[model samples]
Target: MPKLWNETIAEHRRTVREATLETTAALVAEHGLASVTMSQIAKETGIGRATLYKYFPDVESILAAWHEGHVSAHLEHLTRIRDRAGTPGERLAAVLQAYADITHERPQHTEIAAVVHRGEHLAHAEQHLNALVRDLITDAAQAGDIRDDVAPAELASYCLHALGAAGSLPSKAAVHRLVAVTLAGLNLSPSTPDAAGGDD
Candidate 1:
């Protein structure tokens, strides 16, 4: 096949796949996980059942694909937030706040939890998130903005676990308060220079 023809076919397939994934997720969310079927996904996506099958074998597979995309997008977003210009402490705080916000705003459906929790993708994403926070903590400690008495990896784990509570919080204000408390736990010791913003 000509290069242009091959490119067009690839693009078309991508579009169909994305549409099917999106349609399946929406249908499942509306009708519940077990109630959604391949036919429903095809009809809602405006694609044929056969075409949908070429991309995904079952409703569970489609949900898994949709969740993979969602998790990948979230990781990319967190990476962008972490890479932005700021003091180590400031960037760390922003990333933690963004993470808490995402957790707080995520869908609370058990079906979603079921799909997202069973994949190796989740483990890999968790590792990436842990490293992102760990490195930030190390930098903040080096800059004297965060306490150095504890290991960075331990503090990173603590931050993640503590922020996980945001999912159950009743309000955004409460989420912010949670993040503030998590950050405060990393504060420098009172005897440290500039700990109280005193003059040199």
Candidate 2:
């Protein structure tokens, strides 16, 4: 086949696959995971059952793919926030705020969120996020904006754990408050302005 034809075919396949994943996720959200089926996804996606099967073996696989895509997008978003022009502390705060917003405004249903978070993609994403935060913390500490007594990795984990409460917050303000609290834990204290604060 001509290269142009091959590219077109690949693009078509990508479009179909994205549509299928989106439709499946929407159906699952609306009907609950257990109530969704392959046929329903096929119909909702406007694709034949066989065609849907070519992309995904079953609902679980489709959901997994969707979850992976979601996580990849989120990571990319965080990366952008991290790369923005700002002080290390400011950039870290922006990323933390964005993450907290994601939790506050979770797009997936409860069941889907639970299932997707249990997947390997989430574990890897968490690691990537942790590393990103750790780097930020290291920079901030070096700049004297954050406490440096403990390891950056340990502070990163603490930030993640503390900010996780954003998922249960009732409003965006509450999410921002949670991020503020999490960040405060890493901030240099006023009284001990020159003290390198971290767990010994």
Candidate 3:
């Protein structure tokens, strides 16, 4: 086939795949995940069942692909936040806050969230996220902004585990407060006199 023809075919396939993923997700959200079917997806996506099968073998596979795309987008977003101009501590705080916001604002597809997190892609994305935060923590500790008593990797884990509560918080303000408390725990500065009971 000609090069232009090949490129055009690839783009068309990409468009079809995107449409299928979006339609599948919407169906799964509106009707429960267990209640969705490949036939329904094909009808809603406006693609033939054979074409849908060419992209995904089953509904579970389609959902997995959708989840993977969601996670990749999130990781990319966090990477952009981390790369923005700022001191190491400032960048770290920004990343943490952005992560908490993601947790708070993520779609409330309980079943999908539970199933998706169990996938290997999530594990890899988590490792990538951990490394990003660990590098920032190392920078901050070297600058005396965060305590150096613990390893940066350990501190990164602590930050992630602490901020995970944002997913269940009642409001965005609660999520921000949680981020503040998590960051406070990482601070290296001495406690204020008032916080120390004023020279008791």
Candidate 4:
């Protein structure tokens, strides 16, 4: 194929795939994961059943793509939220709060959040997010913003744990309290709140 023709075909393919993902996401949002299906996606996407098969071999493949896309977007959102505040403490809090809100309310993300927070896959995703979060933690510790007794690696592990815990919290008020307490304890500065500041 000519270069222009190939580019056009690729763009169209991307468009189709995105449409399928959006439709699948909407169904997942409204009906939950148990009822999502390739047939339903095909119908929602207004594409032929064969075409859906050509793009994704099965519902699992669609789900894999769906998860990958959600992960990419979530990481980007984390980076953006991290950038929203200047200081490491500020950025860390913002990042956790943003992720808490997302994973708390968004079903697709909440499901993947659970999956990504466990096992080897968690490490796999951490490979992409670790450096970004490490720098934030290191900066805070150096500035006496977070506690120094814990090494950066342990602190980083706790940060991931914090995001997971916040998502698991029952209420928004409760989640915020947890993040605040965790943030204070993570702060190396002695002036910060006592370890027991937030409700357990």
Q: Model 2, 78-194: lDDT tens per residue? A: 999899987777777778888887777766377887777778878899899999989998998998878999999999999888887887788877776677678778873333335
Cα-based lDDT for every prediction? 0.84, 0.81, 0.84, 0.70
* Candidate 3 stretches greater than 4 Å from native: 1-7, 188-200
Q: Which window of 10 residues has the lowest lDDT sum in candidate 1?
A: 191-200
Q: Could you report the Cα RMSD, in angstroms, for every candidate shown?
A: 5.7, 6.3, 6.5, 6.1
Q: What is the TM-score of each candidate against the true structure?
A: 0.87, 0.87, 0.87, 0.74
Task: Write down the TM-score for model 4.
Answer: 0.74
Number of clashing pairs per prediction, in order: 0, 3, 0, 7
How do these models rank on TM-score, best leading? Answer: 1, 3, 2, 4
Per-residue lDDT, model 3, residue 36, is: 92
Any idea what lDDT model 3 has? 0.84
**How many clashes show up in model 3?**
0
- lDDT, candidate 3, 36-154, per-residue tens: 99999999988789989989999878888898998899899989998988677778887888898888888878877776777899899999999999999999898887889999999
lDDT score, residue 3, model 3? Answer: 37
**Native-structure RMSD, model 3:** 6.5
Candidate 2 runs further than 4 Å off = 1-7, 188-200
